[model samples]
Target: MKKILSLFLGVSLLCSSCNDVLDVEDISNYNPELVWNDANLANAYMANLYPMFGNWNTGADAFSQQLAGINFYADRITITNGEFKLWNYGRIRLINQAIVDVNKGRLPDAVKANITAQALFMRAYTYFEMVRYHGGVPYITVPQDRYEDDLAVPRNSTAECFDLIIKDVDQAIAGLPKKIATTSADFGKIDANFALAFKAKVLLWKASPQFNPSRPFNNAYWAQAYEANKKAYDDLKAQGYGLVDDYSNVALVERGKESVFTVINSYPNKVANWDNGVRPGSESRGPASAVPTWEFIKEYPMKDGKMFNDPSGKYYKSEEALLQSFWKDRDPRFAKSIVWNGKVYEVSGKAGKRQYTALGVAHELDDFGVNPKAGVNSTNLDRYTGFFILKNSLLKLAQAEVQQYDVDFVVMRFAEVMLNYAEAANETGKMAEALDILKQIRKRAGIEPGADGNYGITANTTAAMRETILAERNVELAFEGHRFWDLRRLRMLDRLDGTTKHGVEAIAVQANGQDMPIGEAREKANRYELVESDFRYSLLQVPRSGVKVNVVPGKYYFFPIQRDILDRNKNLEQNKDWGGSFDPTLP
Candidate 1:
């Protein structure tokens, strides 16, 4: 396993030829005999597939605004066909080559089955990525050994591609291990549960409104999705997989009980310095690129499980009162996931001391002398949304050692599986089962269950339960990169269009004492006055220069196929609403 770590510790360590997999040339240097005969070599080849996993920490794609809901005005959506539109056949070719060689290898049946199953999983995973992003794609299973052979390949229908994906996953499940130890030796490898979980997710997406936009929702698709999620939930629970006791630490633990699948990492080999992007300026030298939006902050329910925006609730009397009490007596997840004003945080190597994001304290003395908002500005990298992401901050690292924090990114977890099952169950009229699952998640989040043993969810009708499940998913999975996709699949992206994102404005109270304290002390001394702003809309202004942020419903749903790809492959079709001279059918 250590050797496996060495082979896949960094993206640089992967075979250089991997990027050239799509190239139509002689790659006999990477012949099956050279890799498949040796187990270590075979494992190394499989390791290259890890990079293809989705970026979970940042909802990084044209569709998503930066994590903290800051930079709402940035050109988050692609206006035209971009690089991602260009089909990169490299990974598929690599998987095809692996499958080809694994079949020809002389390894023992058990060993060969494991390796082959892994290759199959990669193949299915790759195809799923393609279909999700580009609709139907060319379903190339066999390795293209020659340039002439590669040219003959044609695109397959979306349904056909999904069918192949399912077949590959089903076969992989048949051959993969049911479970493996969380120890370093087996922590990152795919298993039967991983396949099941992924399959359930795939089915749910297939049934989503984005995929099936017909007038009457597809009940059959929803039924299939429900069954798949139920099977995954039951089997995973049987295998001792369940939610971690604390929701805050779920991402911190490596291959914990909650993680069904994760992108494995090891220090120095595959280190992940998430702090480089999300850590506050006061904590690290890295840029604070993703800041939470006021929209996101308002999503969390009150401690009593009531919606924060409920008019009848005494959540706040005024904007100023809300700003002062927002971080106090709220959901336990708030403190663990967000860095707000007046919060005391520790800085590594700064022994017996703490850092505070108090307003009026000059965190950075600009040329204009002491700036009042410097403390919050420095911590927020000047984005000034009045909040920093703490969920995946990796703040334990010192300023100088920000790059060495290595924590595996959980791709799929039991909590999500339960949510998926609950949503599917609710859609299929299994209300009791749905509520039971929600209760378990809310209970783990420190929310008190009601007399009915449910998570105080009074919504018994399907329509009401649907909204509840979506809101719960938003908070529970915040900053883990599911919001954009969830909204897209639910056909709810229109909800964000023209919406303004807001934040609090904190002004520190200046004192006239000789030994005036700073940081947490200043906060405790009531030396800061927090003001809530009325113009908290995301579309109010552009946070990033030279970019327009707008979500055009019809055209923005699917990214356009690249023009170059259309020219290269005449058979390929452009997505709907993306006007181009390209035709869907070849003459």
Candidate 2:
């Protein structure tokens, strides 16, 4: 800002001989009125607004889906930690100011329409995030003057909030461009089809048990979700958007095909931090966060679409027996998403090296009482959940280049919309359509379709199919930030109560009480793996500050507004769950 001011003053000094000083305008300052007067300036203003949406790491791994996390899952989330607070009226004010200025601007009709649509979409997205956390917030459409305007505004009803969100999204759909191709310059920007998909997700939340707990199985709500999701699916399907064949490439490489909405990223610019955060420290030279829990590891079905506990499945056995060959013959996605004992993994600049996680290995150690200087989980004891995440790791990058990973953060994808449609359709008595969608998803995941081509899915009733859809979502959207919010919106956090999440510690033991030549794991893969005689396994109960499992409260569905926020606005009523009269569940 100082540089811009100096340049402006310099230009004024140069033009003093030709013009009057009183007529020169200070353009570098905050000028909302001047922004909408030109098309390119309006675009630059829109660019400034995109950073508020954040990245793909918010809900990626948490207690609702994975075993634990550093913040949201390490312990119970109380009302005051600000974990549940997303008070975004500041963002709403900016967006509303843009909307008002764009409508009043004298720019080209096309430019005005495009900018207005983008602003409306962002506003709707912000409101949806707030509603999901704290139900209805004050629906402020126009910017409130700091000193002149009356600032005491009450919260809107949940129904009124939804109506306003729908209106904004409808305008966005009407004015935004169609789906832009990967080759287009505007590929990552939100398009008409992506707006439609966002609307579908918003309606899905509206129909969920979080909002409709009293009328838990309302067909009207489900119908709304079904219709919107179907429209999005159809519109995007016609625009050449669908699932990419390889699961790893969907979020990493195929930007325009599977990704319905993407937060644009590139190297040396705004780069994605997902790979650096999840990959092992030994491999990526970053923290080994987001390691999978034992329970989460069991969540993946076998290659035949059967749980490992299914008696009829090929590898079904006792717990110890199952852990013996845990890394073998599972779903193709298992190897893609997780790195276990003695498994070959892709690392840049290395020639086919298998990862060893058992104790006594040179690097990988989550074992008790042993320390190594450069192992994967050696330094951070909390990160050693006995398994490391391998979902979106770059297949070819040297350790030094890990910081340069530039995969776009996929906020919404076609596969998620398909899941939304399936859930809504099944709830609204369109069972056949729902099952078909699920089958298509499983097919893309490389699950074996049985002789009848049903993909080993035997959920013949609505209740059963609903469970199946939820389970599929657990794996399909694993590290993409959908798990906790999914369970919250569905009112299924009770699933975590009374449940214990365990970890595994793999120790390298000497067979027959003598050292064996278990050299490289890949060469000795058949004999010296986790299930062999050279290793000992232990079930670990990892706790943070002596707290074992998650004990989420029921009122957590609608969190309380912070005391500071309530103190500022005298008209604001607090949520009843947090000791006030505003019941977030009331429709």
Candidate 3:
């Protein structure tokens, strides 16, 4: 089967296992031999292929860092030198190689289609991440030959890259199976809703303030974003995808219906860990990345669905009293996302108490023994901060020796689709539609769905709905890796700076066997204090190693291209005015 397919495709096909560079003895001599001869070989190869996505060394482990509070610059621990370029180039090579083999018709039609969809989806995904990080990158779709002139490809325009992503997603949606059959082992193929949701995502980013080239907010882009999001929400809802009845259980249950698409991380099938983004209770929680900021924790509106500063609400008080009252009425997601000190969360041992601390002076978990811990100059207090994220941490796994459990990595969810719809509608002046969607999500969360979803707010004006929807998204999707991009896409990065913010508050627990004093002890006991003046820098400067920075005032739009590539491809020009400069200046 593999042989015939190879002959037909006119090239060899090797799956993840066979193509692994780690196992290759002679890298230059690598070639597909048995890959075409066996069905199991093809299956194994395909299955192993996605490891790169999760390979901390390769793909961003997209979910972990994005969901956690880690920033890209200064908080640059997530990205490394040559890291971004390598993964993009490597994955493109894999997809290009597979496309060459599959086009030969040696494989079964189903196999060909499945592989094509996967390749297309991956290529699109690779480009999506690339654009998000680098603004735009060389759109390399095929494997370059030794003498190929495309090796020194210039960076494509961001608009062009977005167009390519839309095209690829469209093709994948058209060619892929509407649904993968239960008997089919070839799971994870791109589906209708997944592709649609992604299309909406791309459109939303494009329509957002940061990338919305149609400045002053283009009506067409807004409408397009709204239409795409609406279709995705409607389609998914029709397919039985809805919010989890009880919002608290959304992440607690693995792969819930609310999750439209997720990077399936099941135990036994794939023995992987996501602790590097988690906290101390788990083996990988060193460096303490993603520590929830006191500001973020305070964003959840009171459970009564009122702002913390509402003059009429019980939450209005001194910062201390305000937080105490605030914590009581906020959405349930707050507790699920943050691990306050003394709040019993799942830990390694049955009776073991997971003590969250700051500086690790009294807490061992805070000391990861690495440079700067989470990042250079990151507050040493961050090392022993008061809270840890519990949203995706597996409670049951706390008891097992390995603590193996399935933590679904949701790529697209019904709730997000709804939120996207609400955002687009509100942006496009469709206030009624926007209000309906926001209310639906709030209803599921067991909130009154009125503060933002009320008739007065919804019926007043489009701008009114806009703020409500954006705030609703923040509270609902807090810490799910959506904030950074959401802020950027919304073009509200700078705007978010002035908003009330919070971070993990640290208090001395113990030092050399001396218990913390009463004032500090009680302060630590509450675990709901707000951090003062939370916003530092909201945007990052494009590093000079890649391309000269030519960003415009009022926006941080510059992205670096490979300097060497520019040397080779003189035709390529850097972003306007940013080709040669060094200053993390505001856009």
Candidate 4:
């Protein structure tokens, strides 16, 4: 169904999520007393405060080099870089003011409760973002007056920050409805399920090594995460959220079955630029571009759920041989999410239009035509890497229709919730449970279940399970902005040190010189391009030859508070790892 409205729409018909400031319509001109007393006006006020939640573009993925950009070639992230600093006291104060005023509003008790609950949820969300970047921000629940209130508030401890987050989430859950259907008017609005899943995610981060480096695994923190995620998983499952059978169709529908929470999107009014980022500028109407890096391509497994180079996987071959067939026989998601050379990509409302990325590999004018253009103009998209992220692209959209791309951007989905639950379960010695979730996810991705029905999952031990879960998360949640945080939470940024991620740069040749078979790429090439064979692959580093990926600073786990923010707040201490007295990690 085409969702007519999102959370902003659910709150008030006149409200638009496009505007994320409280005073969008100069609400300051209206009497605060009258606005709060009126239900519709109060709802509109809160609607403006809801931060558009989904990472609609290449955001956190850039930090992990999953999406190509300058970040992919960066040497390291320093405290001075301030790559992750979210000190939004202004928004926090707004939420606090909303919570305070909504309570005093003369609306009915239920109406007052709903608005207050939503405000609290937003507050939790804002704080979560803050803590994720700069751990232990001031945990202020009430709006502070600049002139009267103590302006020098010290940063709260990590424990206190999370305590308040969970406390607010619990209260929000109590006031919100259990489940709001994606088809309902309140489709994108925060509900009990949304809050619960968010709580689980928050707890998962809290339990991670980012906060508790002392206890690596099997700690009280993981147990807390287990309970919250299990509750979320059970509650969400009972309410009918699961993996959409076909991966290709998952993001096509607005607030589809697997989505636990998504920001409501409608073209013109509130458009997501996801299409513009995925589609190259050649076929796209917008200039934004983000393609999968070589790291992400290798991260995906073979069709039966094994790495291309895995010794026990379906395909074990040399680096050259593997990258040659990299476009073929992979996790079914590879087909759903990648657009490589000679791949048939739908655009201009037509099927069988080939995307020729390799040099000299020009596509036929149309599938029925034998003639080739003078040059490889169709391949001009020449995506940064050898491929483009086809994840959630609107396949049938004509080039002009890209501006109308309004697919609901999923924030938290059942797949991620399951991953969260599985991680917690594995850390708590529930390997079987964790493995089961992985299997289900693989099944949904169309991985073939072998005779033993293992789906090529080989991890058995807890540590191995941890590795597999994190690896699975990379592929299952690629480009959704999860990888960088996952690496940080696991305290594994060291893995990126001196790492040279690879990308394929293909060039067409007269005869196939490569040893490996091109697999299904030939079939796709035959259907969409003038040349179907004799392509040679070049293994190129994603970055320039000498650029190093050194992430040595421990302070990077919790980004430092911005220098300006520190200059403004005299009492707020910097994190200990950042050469200050306060500790961001939990006690």
- The numbered model that scores best in lDDT is 4
Order the numbered candidates by lDDT, best leading. Answer: 4, 2, 1, 3
> Native-vs-model 3 lDDT?
0.55
Give TM-scores for every candidate, taking all chains together and pairing residue i with residue i. 0.86, 0.89, 0.75, 0.89
Please list the C-alpha lDDT of all candidates, in the order they appear: 0.66, 0.73, 0.55, 0.74
Listed per candidate, the RMSD to the true structure in angstroms reads 5.0, 5.7, 8.2, 5.0
Model 1 bad stretches (over 4 Å): 7-26, 54-80, 83-86, 150-152, 311-320, 349-362, 365-382, 451-453, 510-549, 580-587
Greater-TM-score candidate between 1 and 4? 4
| Candidate 1 minimal-lDDT segment of 10 residues | 531-540
Residue pairs in steric clash, candidate 2?
A: none
**Candidate 1's C-alpha lDDT?**
0.66
After the best TM-score superposition of candidate 1, give how far the Cα of residue 479 lies from its true spot, in angstroms: 0.8
TM-score of 3: 0.75
Candidate 4 lDDT score at position 328: 71
What is the clash tally of candidate 4? 0
Q: Local error of candidate 4 at 336, Å?
A: 0.6
Q: Which tens-of-lDDT digit does each residue in 411-447 have in candidate 2?
A: 7889998999999899899999999998888898898
- Better-scoring candidate (TM-score), 1 or 3: 1
